[model samples]
Target: MAYISYLDLPKHWGLERGDRVLLTSDIMQLMFTTMRNGERFDRDAFLDAILGVIGEEGTLLIPTFNWDFCHGVAFDYHKTPCKTGALGGFALSRPDFRRTQHPLYSFAVAGKDQQLLCDMQNVSSFGVDSPFGYLEKNHGKNVIIGIHYTDCFTFVHHCEEVCGVDTYRFSKTFTGQYIDAEGQESTRSYSMLVRSYELYEATDLTLIGEKMERAGVAHVIVLNEIPYRIVDLTAAAPVICDDIKNNSSRGICKHKLQ
Candidate 1:
């Protein structure tokens, strides 16, 4: 097998030097193809490939969200593990990664803008002060690997919050034990723009992801049988938001169950 190294990343993903990227992935599937027999996947090498392409001036943000916090579980920023998947957990374990304190939706950051993301204080999960908002502000790309958008296109929800598309979501507050950056414990309340279950039917955001791909801001690549998508959130958000606003028939919100 011809191995793809860290040096091959930029060309494959069309990543620019020093570009900041928010990565959402399930490394397991990719590993199935990329890893050789009887050897554990080297997460460090995968991370290095990404970090190498982004270079010193770039930043990498990985979702470390834990929904249990929304249901009254305490969130210790220093110890609470991300339920997202292997890649997320690996990112969290890195000493350089700093996680934001949002109970339901949090992000772990490394590289140039770690402090900026760690300082986010958005009470609302997708509010302007959240990590999603920060990614947009920095003109970052949202890269999804070995998973479909329906599984984790979180940035879309941020755009919905920004557009005030409240037809299918309601604001709710959760109180939990939170540990701040300084390791101080405090009882805190945070808001989440939760979907109204009665109004939702498990819609697939992959269709919207496909739409973005057609529009040129989203790119898809297949390597060793694993699929990867790279989307410019700054460009894709407006298109998605408008689709939500004007086309109720084809809207992301679903009214029927699958």
Candidate 2:
């Protein structure tokens, strides 16, 4: 059984009124029934559940994985159903934004201060053509959160090895544009990747924590059992990985709880 309850998560995670919360894919699946017997995708219900948590001015963070882009081409992970990518569903549902080209990096928003930082690839074919692109345009003060996996950020490292440029020299960009159902166009851009490191040593946790703090995010709760170090955030960073050999399960890091 899982340790957290999606319905009761706000209270369990100690979320106060007006606090923003992020949900991972595992949490999303556990909370909403988008798939019934593995068939229909309940788009409305999924969106409603998310909106329920994000009342107003509240943010939700989600990781967008680009498995398809990395498979065989970049980091080959020998596994079936390996060609999947990640998208911020909340961002997709918004009104002012729309994803343009390169599904992985092309989220567009209409607001002046809206921020989305994606570090995954393979988003080229993710139904980001219609209303998805709409939300990409109006991202103003509302926060549409995005995150990258520990391994994906290594692109910066790859650039160093291949181009001889420092990780600091590399920058990722995401662009979005508008199009009618029949197809017309307009565009915008944002930075995606920041830094890189080797897989074993690569982790954006510190940066993630810093961003959360800057965003005024209060409590961060982990559902997995993977052990990790909490660098700059005040919340308890728990290990929720199920693999016993994983660092969290083995308590490899003293900062992590077993």
Model number with the top lDDT: 1
Model 1 C-alpha lDDT versus the unseen true structure:
0.78
Q: How do the predictions measure up, each by TM-score?
A: 0.92, 0.35
lDDT of 1 by residue, 29-100 (tens): 766655553445678777877888888899998888888887777888777888887787788887877787
- Judged by TM-score, which candidate is best? 1
Relative to the true structure, how large is the alpha-carbon lDDT of every model? 0.78, 0.32
Please report how far candidate 1 places residue 161 from its true position, in Å. Answer: 0.6
Off by over 4 Å in 1: 1-7, 36-40, 249-251, 256-258
RMSD of 1: 2.4
- Residue pairs clashing, model 1: none
